[model samples]
Target: MLQLCRDASGAPLAPQGSVVCIGAFDGVHLGHRALLARARERAAALGARTAALSFEPIPREFFARGTPVPRIDDARGKIVQLAAAGADLLLLLRFDAALAAMSPEAFVEQVLVARLGAREVWIGADFRFGHARRGDPVLLRELGARLGFGVEVFPEFLVDGERVRSSGIRAHLAAGDFDAAARLLGRPFMIGGHVVRGQQLGRKLGYPTANFRLGRRTSPVDGIFAVRVHGIGPVPHAAVASLGVRPTVNGTEPLLEAHLFDFDGDLYGRRLDVEFVAKLRDEEKFSDLDAMVRQIDLDAAQARSLLGVPEARPAGACA
Candidate 1:
């Protein structure tokens, strides 16, 4: 389990011997993994707890007022992924204007040195912090020497002969290249949300679906995809998902509608983690209901095949 802490008075909570990694850690992608692995190794050698310090709303989102910015995952999902990466403590800092106004020295003295009691700090090569983004790895190294702490900066990580980064991943996902994005992330790109009630038009079309309203404004891709729905159990169910505003229905907000293959049960209010396996097709507005139904059938077959779900099963067995 990871503990969340908030401090603004420059008061130390943990003992003065923690190993900390500071960043946005939005996607927890391969680049983040490299930094975290180094932090874990250093923490073990120094006999200190490993902590990841991150911020909510990200600075860009906070400043942009929910403009057209791409987010790989929400804050909650990021915490869950970071916790799974072997962090002992997860610090979610509030990124309001007050906190953002702190100088580089104050940030180090108050947040890193005082509140977390950080004995060692790990960050990426391009890491920067404090008011107007004045802090840098070089500055941190100098400060660490005077503050009686150590600083380690990891080089940029590469994937597919390109520098791996959150922005690159977002670009690939936006272009509907899930496989390339997955290679950079070391896992499938996933969207999680609660199943909400829709217009039930799909049910009328003979293809009942569960609709999900994303918690974040930015989604990676807007298309139909073959996906795996988790949070149901260990075995991920095969499904076909549509992510976009329904032009045919004249809907306004972007939505995700997933039709589970060979499954029957009410999923209303149940939170689902939908992992994109492959892009089936870009979202399109069909001329008629019959055309849409035909395309959905094709999508279902492709999704099942892509997920490796057996075409035939034993009698009375779920597909």
Candidate 2:
């Protein structure tokens, strides 16, 4: 069973000692999978369980702008992906002021030695931690030697002769290169969240949508797109969606408004995973609702063609 631990002060993740890895793990991309594999391998060799220690609110999110942090994956997706990659436990520590205030020694003593009982810690070549980002792999290794555990710094990951970076993937997504983004991720870039009620503006404009909000979280792209919606029932569904603040509607927050083709029934509060297929256009404001409606009609048509699915226009669409 995989454990999801939120409080760092809780019982030690693995009392028998653990092999552990830590990172932002924003995308759990190909590179992150490699890191996790190494942790799992070391765990197996030592006959110990594995733990993945990551921060909630991601350090970037906490320190950067409040909205649209340009993230590749959300929290729940990271946890699920990490577990599937063989982590026995996930420590999603809250990144609050106290955590940010802790010195390098304190972080290792409290979280690594106390909370996780880590027999060995593994991280990438550029990993850093502690208050004011003062700790690096060198510091960790030195501390580990004196503290009785060991530290290993893995080489930077490479894909196609280039290093894989979450920022690079975000840049690809922002540029509307879904293929390039997916190449870095080892899978299509997607966001997963439970459906939340929206203003129903899409419905009034002839497209009913199931909405998800990034909510002070970061998103890499903002535009109309062709997409696939998974975790709806069983099979994935082709869809047209807009991911951004609804400018034409005078919206302010980042929201994902997905219009699943030919579907009906309540989706509110149900988990929806949206896979980006292709970008249609940038988000822009229309002078009037009628103009916005016409553009949406075109967007829906383009999406249907891109997805190779016939238009499933909801009943009562404007002529």
User: Which segments of candidate 1 are over 4 A away from where they belong?
Assistant: 6-11, 308-319
C-alpha lDDT of candidate 2 relative to the true structure: 0.88
lDDT of each: 0.85, 0.88
Total clashing pairs for each candidate: 0, 1
Best by lDDT: 2
Each prediction's TM-score versus the true structure: 0.90, 0.92
Query: Which parts of model 2 are misplaced by more than 4 Å?
Result: 65-68, 311-319
| lDDT for each residue of candidate 1 in 107-195, tens digit (9 for 90 to 100) | 99888888788899988888889899999998999999999899988787888688988988999998888889999988989999889
TM-score of 1: 0.90
Q: Flag clash pairs in model 1.
A: none
How do the residues 1-319 of candidate 2 rate in per-residue lDDT, one tens digit apiece? 7888888686777888899899999888888899889888888898888999999889877887464376787787888889888888888999988898989999998899989898999988878899989999899989999988999887878888878988888889999999998988999989888899988877888799999988655788889999999997778899999998788878888899999888878999998789999999999999999999999999999999999997555579865
